[model samples]
Target: MADPKGFMTTPRQEWPRRPVEERVRDWHEVYVPGALLPIVSKQADRCMDCGIPFCHHACPLGNLIPEWNDLVSREDWRAASDRLHATNNFPEFTGRLCPAPCEAGCVLAINQPAVTIKNVECAIADRAWEEGFTSPRPPERLSGRTVAVIGSGPTGLAAAQQLTRAGHTVAVYERDDRLGGLMRYGIPAFKMEKHHLERRLEQMRAEGTKFRPSTAVGQDIGAAELRSRYDAVVVATGATAWRELPVPGRELAGVHQAMEYLPQANRVCEGDLEVSPLSAAGKHVVIVGGGDTGADCLGTAVREGAASVTQLDIYAQPGTERDEDAEPWPTYPKLYRLSAAHEEARDLGTAPAADADARLFAASTLRFGGDAEGRVRRLHLVEVDAGRRPVPGSERTLPADLVLLALGFSGPDRSDGLVDQLGLELEPRGTLARDAGFATNVPGVFAAGDAARGQSLIVWAIAEGRAVAAAVDRYLTGRSRLPAPISPYDRPMTV
Candidate 1:
C-alpha cells in the first residue's frame, strides 16, 4: 500500500474548474489546464485499497482502480499509466465524460467522500501522452484476416484498435467527414477539446488501423458488399434516433432536438461554420429534459448568450442525500448534484422562473404557443406529481423563444439503411438484436455499443467494444488472447 493511514489522513479533492465568467466567453474546456496534476496524487492516496474493491464491480470495464491508485500515490506514473490502459482504451474520454460510478461505489463512500478516481485517471492519461508513454503498438505479425467496423464512435474505435493490435487488418468507416463520431461533433469543446481526439487518431493511423471518413456503409458501400469484402463486420453505430416531443405546436420555428442544436455549435468550433444557424444568442431558451444532454444544452446556451435558460425535469427533485429505503449505498443513487453547467446558470441568474439552479422539478410540458410567424414564443406547462400526472391548479407559462428537446435517443438511425441492407434483426426496443457473444443473427456481422445495448455511458461503450473485438477475434481464429471485460446481459448495478 502507498500509505496505510492515507485514507484517514487525507481528504478528497476534485480538479478545479475554470471561473464561470471566464469559461462562458470561450469554447475551451471548463477545467483549468494543468491544475489537476498537482493535487491528484494526494487524492489518489485516499483510496483505502479496500479488500472487496467495489469500485471494480461498479465499472463496466473492470478498471484496476485500487492498483492504479496505489501506483499514483507512490508517484509511479509509468506503472499507473500501464495499469489504467490495461482495461480502458480511452481513459481520457472516460475521465472527462463518465459520471464516475466507481466513485459512487467506493468503499470509502459508504461514509466519507470517495477518492478522486476520475481526476486521477485523467491525470494519468494526460501525463502518459506528455511523457511519451503512449505510442503505436503495431501487430507483430499479420493474421491474414480483415474486419470492417461501421461507425467511428467510441465503441467502433476501441474495437478497431484492439482488432488491429491482434494482427487483423481493420478499417473503420465513419459517415461524418471526420472520425471520433460524437466526440468529433456531438460533444461541445467546452467539455473536451478536439486535439486530444486528433492525437489518438494519429496513433491509430500509425498503428495500421485504416480510417474511411465520410463513407456511409449502407449508402456508399452496401452492407452485403462490405461483408463480402471483409472476413468479418462489426457494427458499432451509436443510438442516435432522438425521441421527439409530440406536444402541440411542435411544428413551430426555432424549436429543435438537442442533437440538432449541439452539432451546429460544434461545427462553429470546427471552423465549418461562421456561426450556428440555431444559435441561442439573444433568445429565451427552455430545455425539456434533466439529463446530461439537457445540461450540455444549458451550458451551450449560456455560452451563446441566451437571454434565459431553464431546464425541466419530469420527476420530482431528488433529495441531496441518498434514501436508504429507495436507493441504498454501493449503487448509484438519485441525488441532487450540481453540475458545472447548472452552476453557471444559477450564478448568472439566467432562468429566473425556475429554482436557484434554473431547474424546475416535477414539471410536465402541455404545449407551446407561437406568434403569427409560427415562431415559438411561450411554453405551457403544469406542475406534476411523482407519477407524472398533472396537478390540479398549477398550470403556468414561460416565455420561450427557443425550445430544445433533450429527451434522449431511441436506437440506431436506420435511415442510413445499414440495418436493412444487412438484413439484421432488431430488438423490440429498437436496438440491434445480439446474442450473449455480441453477434447479430447474420453470421459474420456483430453489433456492439449503443446500437446493441441502447443508449448508455461511454465506459460501457468502450467495454462493449473490447468485448465484441474478443468475440470477433475468436471467430476468426480457433483461439484468441483478447480479453472480454463484460457480457451482453450485464446491466448496471441498481437497487
Candidate 2:
C-alpha cells in the first residue's frame, strides 16, 4: 500500500474526456491528452488490495489488478507494465476497448465506486510505450516446431505472439490486407487509434512472428494443405457473420450491415481509401441497434456530417442503476451507459438533445419506405413491449437516407470456405466446435476466440488465444509449459 489511508483519503477521479462539441468534428480519441495521469495514482491507490482480489477472477485475462494498482500508486510504471503484460499480451487494446468488468468486480465497488483499475491500466500501458519499456522478447532457442494461426484478430495475434515467444515458428494468416483483423478495420479511430495496433504488430514481427495478410485460408491455401505444412493449426478467425435485420425493406438502398459501414469509415480514416462508398455525409442516418457497434456508427456518421442520427433498440431501456436481482454484486450490471458517441450526439441536438443522444428503446423497425428510385427515404417503426410485439397504434415514420444495421454478429463467416474445406464441425450455435483443449475434430487443428466462442470482449479473445496456444503446443510436442488462462468450462466472474 503506497499510503495506508490512501483509499479513505483520495476520492475517485475519472479520466476527463474531450469536450463533446470539439471531439465530434474529428476522428481523434475522446479523452483529453495527459488527462488521466494526474488522478490515476490516487485512484489506483484506492484499491483495497483485497484478500482475494476478485478483479482477477472478473477479468478473463486474469490481470494482476491489485499488484498493478499498487505499482501505479507508487509511480513504478515500468513494474506496473510488467505485471500487466504477464497475463495480457495487449494491454493497450484491452485497456481501451474492454468495458472493465474487473472494475465492476472490485471489492471497493461492493460499496463505493470502484478503484479506477481500467484507467490505471491504460496509464501503465501508455507510459510503457512512451518510456520504451515495451519490447519484443524473442526466445533464446528454437523449439523446432511450427504453428499456423488463421486470422489476425486479437486472439490470433495473442496466440501467435505467445507461441513465438515459446520458441515455436508461427505464421499468422489474415484475409484482410493488413494485420490486426477487426482492430485494423472494424474499430473506429475515435475509439482507439490504429497506431496502437500497428505498434504491437511491429513488436510481434520483431519477435519472429511471420504475418501473411490478404491470404484467405480456405480459398488461397486449402485447409488441408495448411494443416500438412504446420505441426499445429490454430483457428482464431473471429466471428464475421453479421446478425442481419430480415425486415421487409432490408433490400432497399442505404440499408447496410454495421460491418459493411464501419470498415469503410475506418479505411477512409487510414487514408487508404480516398472516399467511403457509404459516406454518411448530409444524410439522415438511423442505426438499428443500441450496442457498441451502433455507438461506433453514430460517431462515424457525426464525423461524416450526417444531417441527423438515431439509434434504436428493440429491448426496453436499461435502468440507470444496477438491476440487483438480475445482476447481483460482482456481476456485470445492466445499467444505462453514456458512450463518447452518445455524448457527441447529445451536444449536437440531432435527436432528443435533452436526453443524451438519439436513442429509442422499446422500438422496432417494421419496414423501409423508399423513393421512386428505390433509395431508402424513410423508416417505418412501432413501439413494442417486452415480448417485442407491436404495441397498439404506435406506428411512426422516421426519415432516413442511410440505414446501418448494427444488430451484432452471429458467428464466423463460413462462406470463405475455411470451415467447409477443413471439414470442421460447428456447434449448434454456429461457432466452431472444439473439445476440452480447443481442438477441433480434425487432428492438429484447434479453434479459439470468436471463431470458437462467438462474439465477445477483446480480453476474452486474448485469453482464449493464449489458452489455445498452450493446447496447440501440447498437441505438437506431446507436453507443454504454456499457461492456459481459462479452461473451456471455466465461468468468468463477470462484474
Candidate 3:
C-alpha cells in the first residue's frame, strides 16, 4: 500500500456539480467538466485497502478498487487505467451511472464518509481517454467463429467487444436507428453526454466489432434464421417491458409510462425530434414511483420547464444516515441519497421546502381524473400507513396535467418475438431463464444482462456481458481463456 496512513490524512471529497440554475438551462451533465481530476488522487488516498475489501464483494463487476486507489495515490495513472480496464469493459458508463455499491461497502463508510471511489474511477477513465491510452485492441489471430449479439446496451457491447478481442467475428445488432441501445435513447444527455458513448463506439468499431443498427432479430430478420446463420448467438436485450400503474382511469391520454416519456426526450437530444411528443413543458407533472427512473423524469421535466413536479412513493421515508441497528456494516445500506436530479429539484423549490425533497413518502395514487377530452387533468392520492393501507381521511387531489408511471420495468419486451421465436424459457419473475453458464435452454443460445437478470444497474449489465462472453467462448471452443466475473444467477445486495 502506497502511503499506508493516507486514509487518515485525506478527507473524502467529491466533484462539485455546476450550479443548478446554470446547468438546468442546458442539456449537459451537472458536474463541472474536468472537476474530478484535481482531487481524485487525494480522494484515492482515502482508501484503507482493508484486508477483506468488502467493496470487491459489493461491486457486481468485482473491480479492483483498492489496487486502483493505491495506484492513483502513487501517481501511476497508466497502471490505474490498466487495472480499471482489466475487469470492466466500460468504466466510463458505470462511473457515471452506477449507484456505487462499492462505496457503500467501504470500511470508512462504517463510520466516517467513504472513499470517493466512483469519482476516482471516472477520473481514471477520463484520463485514459484524454491520454490516448485506450485504443483498438484487435486480436492477432482470427478464431474463425462468427457470433451474433442482440442489443447494443452495456451488456451486448461488452460481450461484443470481448468476443471481438478474442478473435471472434462479432456482430452487434441493435433495434434502434443508432447503436448503444438504452445508453443512446433511454438515458438523458444531462446524466451522460453522447460523446462518451460515441468515443467508445469508435474504439469498438476499430477493434473489429461490427455493428448492425436499425435492425432486430425475430422481426427484421427471423430468429430461426439468425440462429442458423451465426455459429452462436448472445441475447443481451435488456428488460424494457415497463411496469404499469394499474389504477382507476389508467387509460387517460396524458398518463404515460416513464419509458415512453424518457425515450422521446433522449431522441430530441439526438436531434431526431424538435421536441418530445409528450413534453412536460407548462405541465404540473405527478411522477408515480420514487426510484431512479422517477428522479430521471423529474430532471427531464425541470429542463422542459414544467410548472410543478411531485413524485410519490409507497414506502416510508428512509433515514438520511445509515441505521446501523437495521443495516450493519459490510452490507449496502439504503441511506437516503440526493441525486443530481433531486438536488436540482430542491434548488428549484419544487421539492418540499421542509427537506427539499420532492418525494412524498407513504403516498399512494388512488386514481386519476381526466378532462372531457380523455386527457388526464388531475391525480387522486391517499396517505398510506407502513402496511401500504390507505390512511383514514387522507384522500386528496393534485393538479396534474401529465402523469408518469416511473414504476420501473418488469422484463424484456417480447413484442419483437425474440423469446417466442427462439423458444427461450423465462423465469417466474418474467426474465429469461439461464443455466449456470449463462446459456439458455436451447443449445448455441445464451442470455445475459437484463434479459436474463431482469432490470438491474449498468454495473451488473457489464458484468453479465463479460461473463456471458466467457461462457460463449467456452461453448464455441473445446477450451477457453476468458475470465468469467460471476455466475449466471449471482446477484449483488440490493441497496
Each prediction's RMSD to truth: 0.8, 1.3, 1.3
Instruction: Report the C-alpha lDDT of model 1 over 169-188, residue by residue, as the tens digit.
Output: 99999999989988888888
User: How do the residues 1-495 of candidate 3 rate in per-residue lDDT, one tens digit apiece?
Assistant: 777777888777889999999999999999998778888888898899889899998898889999999999888989999999999999889889988989989988888899988998999999999888898899999999999999999999999999999999999999989999888887889999999999999999999999999998889999999999999999999999999888899999899998889999998888989989999999989999988899999999999999988999888888888877777776777767899988888878775422347778889999999989999999999999989999999888888899999998889899999999999999999999988988899999999999888888899999999999999999999767887888987877653
For residues 1-495, could you state the per-residue lDDT of candidate 2 as single tens digits? 887787788888888999988888788899999999888988888988889998988898889898999999899998999999999999999889999989878888887888888888999999999999998899999999999999999999999999999999999999999898888888899999999999999999999999999999999889889999998999999999999788888889989998999999999988989879999999999999988989999999999999999999888888877767778778878788888888788778777512346798889999999989999999999999999999999888899999999988888999889899989999998999999999899988999999889888888999999999889888877888988998765665543
Clashes of each: 0, 0, 0
Q: Pick the lDDT winner.
A: 1
User: How many clashing residue pairs are found in candidate 1?
Assistant: 0
| Winner by TM-score | 1
lDDT of 3 at 228: 97
Q: For model 2, what is the error of residue 200's alpha carbon versus the real structure, in angstroms, after optimal superposition?
A: 0.5
- Give me the overall lDDT of model 3: 0.90
- Backbone clash pairs in model 3 (N, Cα, C under 3 Å; residues 3+ apart or in different chains), count: 0
The superposed Cα distance between candidate 1 and the true structure at residue 385, in angstroms, equals 0.4
Residue runs of model 2 more than 4 Å from their true location after superposition? 353-356
Candidate-wise lDDT, in order: 0.94, 0.89, 0.90
The TM-score obtained by model 2 is 0.98
